[model samples]
Target: PARRPPPSARRLMAEAGVAAAAIPPSGPGGQIRKEDVVRALEARPPAPAPATAPAPVAPAPQALRAVPEGDRERVVPMTPLRKTVARRLVEAQHTAAILTTFNEVDMTRVLALREQHGERFLARHGVKLGFMSFFVKASVEALRAFPAVNGEIRGESVVYRDRYDIGVAVGGGKGLVVPVVRDADARSFAEIEEAIAGLAKKAKDNRITMEDLAGGTFTISNGGIYGSLLSTPILNPPQSGILGLHKIERRPVVEDGDRIVVRPMMYLALSYDHRLVDGREAVSFLVRVKECIEDPERMLLEV
Candidate 1:
C-alpha cells in the first residue's frame, strides 16, 4: 500500500519561503536554487520559540519543497532569444584570443574645442555635436594605418577590409546595443552624429533592425554614459577590436616644463584579439589615435 503524505506539512510548505517546522509530510526532488534561498532569507521570519525540553519539533519548513512527479503534466513552453546570445558568448570565450591595452587621453583640448564650437555647429547643422564623431574619425584613421585592428582571422587566413564600418554603443533599459554606421571614414562629423542619433533613438524605441546590427568592422563602447572611469570591453563577434570610452573628469597633472595644472582627462581602452594583433602594433596604433584626437587639425588634414 502506498503511504500517504502528511497533509498538514504539505499544505503549509506550499506557501513559498516557509520554514520547515512541524511539516507533517512532503514530496521530494525540488531543492531551491541558491538564488531562491538568498531571496527567501532576505524576508524576516517569526522569532524562534524558547528552548524546549525535547520534542522532535518538525524540521523548519524548507526553502522549497519538491513537486511530486505524478503531479506534472506535459506542456509546451515558449523560448527566449537568449540561447543565440549564450552560444555566441561561449564561442567568443573559446575560439578568440583576447587582449586589452589601456591609454588615457587628455580631454581638455577636445572638450574645449567642442565647448567652443558645439553650440554653433549644432545650430548650423541641426544636430548635436558629440565626442563620438571625433573618436570614430580617429579610430578609423588608426584602423587604416594598422589594418590588423580592422581585419579578422578565418581559419588561419587574414581578411582585410578597405571600408570602415564603425559601431556606436547605445543603451536602453534592457542592455547595450551597438549600431553600425558604415563608411565612417568617408562621413563628416555632422553625418556621423546624424547616424548615431537615429540609431540611438531606434534602439531606445526597441525598433532597431537586424541590418543595423550587422557587419561592423570595429566597435566603440562608450561606457562614459554610465560614468565608468575605465573598463576593458569585450569584442563583438566577427570584429577584432573594441574601444572603451570612459568618463571625462578633471584631474591635476604635470605639463611640459614640470608645472602642475588641472586638466580634463578621459581614459581609453582598446581590447583586441591577441591572436591577430601584437602589443607593439596595438600601442602604436592607439598612440596615433590619441594624437589625432588631441590635435584635431591632424584629422582635418587627413594625416
Candidate 2:
C-alpha cells in the first residue's frame, strides 16, 4: 500500500497523467517526492489494454505515440541568465530607435593575408590567427571615423567615447554572453587574438565575471560560425550598435574589369540606435569597415 501524497504532488501527478500507485516513493519515510512523480510521468508509456481483454483492440500507431503534448512535453523554468537576456532584448526593442544597414565584402585579400602569415602568427602568439582580430581592428578604425556609431544617448544628451572597448558575442554554456575586449584599438592583432581567446575560454568554462562582460561601447556578433547567411542583429542596451557577421560564401560577381568571376564574399549587417546615429553616418561607417576588411592594410594605415 502507498501513502497519500501531498496536495501539490497529487495535482502534478494527475496533470501528468500518472497514477499515484505507479510511482515508487523516494522521499523520507517512504513519501513520494514531486521529482519522483515527474520522473515516473516522464518514463510512463501509453496505456496498454487489459491483460486478458486485449485481443479485440489493435495497438495505437507509433506515429500517434510521438504526438507532442501532455506526457510528450516537459516544462522547465527559465534560468536566470536566460531571463536576463530576454529582458534586455525586449528593453532594447522598446528603448532604442533601431535600424539595420547591410553590405557585402570581398574577402580575397584578407584570406590571402591569413594564408600567408597564419602559421608564423600562430607560432609567435600561441593562438591561431583568426578573422575576429581583423574585424575588431577594422571596427575600431570605422568607429574612429564615424564617432556616432560609438556614441550612446544618455538621458537627453549623446555621449561619445574615445577609447574602443568592443564586445565579442560568444555562446557560453549558460547563454549568449558578450565579453568586452578592452582598448581594442591600441592592441596589436596578436594581442587582440590572444585576449579574445582567453575571454572565450572563460565564457565556455563558466568563469566569466561581471567585469569581463561590462563597459563595451560596441558589439560584434559572428553568426557565421553557426552557418547564419544573413541576419539583422539587435542592439545591446546602452550600447548604440552591433555588427553582425555572416558565413562567407563563394559567389559569382563582376570584378574590376566587369568580368564575372567567383569570389569569396561575406554579408555584413550593422544594427544601430537610429536616435544617436544618422542613416548616412551608419552606412558610411559600415562601408569603412568593408574597406578595411577588404584591404586589411587600410587599417594599418588608418585610412
* Most accurate candidate by TM-score: 2
Q: Candidates' TM-scores?
A: 0.73, 0.77
| Count of backbone collisions in candidate 1 | 9
| lDDT at position 254, candidate 2 | 95
lDDT of 2 by residue, 221-277 (tens): 999999999999999988999999999999999978889999999999999999989
What C-alpha lDDT values do all the predictions have? 0.78, 0.88
Query: Model 2: residues >4 Å from true position, as ranges?
Result: 1-71
- Candidate 2 has an lDDT of 0.88
| Candidate 2 C-alpha error for residue 172, in Å | 1.0
